[model samples]
Structure formats: structure tokens, C-alpha cells
Target: MPERAPHGTSPSHPSPEAYAALESLLRASPRGRWFLAEYARRNRTAETEMLLEAIARIERAVLKPAPRQAVPSNV
Candidate 1:
């Protein structure tokens, strides 16, 4: 694996939720996918995989939240 850019010095090592957001953006954009692929190629490392997994976990967590309904107002 390639060496990381030191702790806290790299890309802020965003949270799982942040990663999921990135994944969403990538999926929503054709150019984003290309960007991700190119980025991975240039900065291949264990951290990258971890980031991707974090993204997946975040997606699951966000989607698993319970739904709430608004109460009806009395006329």
C-alpha cells in the first residue's frame, strides 16, 4: 500500500456519512465516477478502501432511519 499523507494532513478523512455523500455524488454524476476512478488510481491505499466501506455503511445507516408522520391539525 502507498504511504498516507500523514494523519489529519490528508483529505480530512471524512466521516462515514461524508463518504456516503461522496458516493451519492459520484453515482449522480457521470464525470464524478471518472474522477473517483482516476483518483483511486493515483492514490491507491488501504485508506481508500476504508473510505469506500465507510460510504456504504453511512448509506445503510441513513436509509435505515424510521419514518415519522406529521400530526393532523384540528380544523
Candidate 2:
């Protein structure tokens, strides 16, 4: 069985590896992507909200801004 997350709390960071794999799969299969759209169109508002939330989480986790470098001091 796959490892399960505990109830009531979510992970801090989404798995980048998993995200890449899923993205590749979706991109490779137009039919699969179309199925997702069909399901979303047929589903209720809550279903769309759920997908939006998940996508947001992944975007946030993997697209964090890079840390800035300090300016050099004048001599």
C-alpha cells in the first residue's frame, strides 16, 4: 500500500518529482487531458474548486522565488 498522509493536516511542500512525472504524462496524452476537461465540465462547482486548490498548491510549492544576492560594498 502507498504511504498515506495523516488526517487534518497537509504537507508543507509538494513533491517536485511527482509533479514533473504527472505533468509529463498529461502532456503526452491529449486524450487524458481532454478527459479531465470533460469531467470538470460535467462536475459541480466544488469539483472545480478542489482542482484549483490542488493546482495552486503545486504551483506555490515548485515556483517559489529564488533568494536574492547581496550587493557588493563600495571600496
- The model with the greatest lDDT is 1
- Summarize candidate 2's per-residue lDDT along 1-75 as a digit string, tens digits: 976779988766659998888767876788978876776787867788899999999999889998898888983
Scored against the true structure, residue 8 in model 2 reaches a CA lDDT of 89
**Model 1 whole-model lDDT (C-alpha atoms):** 0.85
Report residue 72 deviation for candidate 1 (angstroms). Answer: 99
Cα shift from native, residue 55, model 2 (Å): 24
Residue 31 shift from truth in candidate 2, angstroms:
3.5
Candidate 2 TM-score, true structure as reference: 0.36
Q: After superposition on all CA atoms, what RMSD does each candidate show versus the true structure?
A: 15.7, 14.5
Clashes of 2: 0
Error of 1 at 62 (Å): 52
lDDT of 1 by residue, 46-74 (tens): 77888999999999999896888787897
State the lDDT at 30 in candidate 1. 84
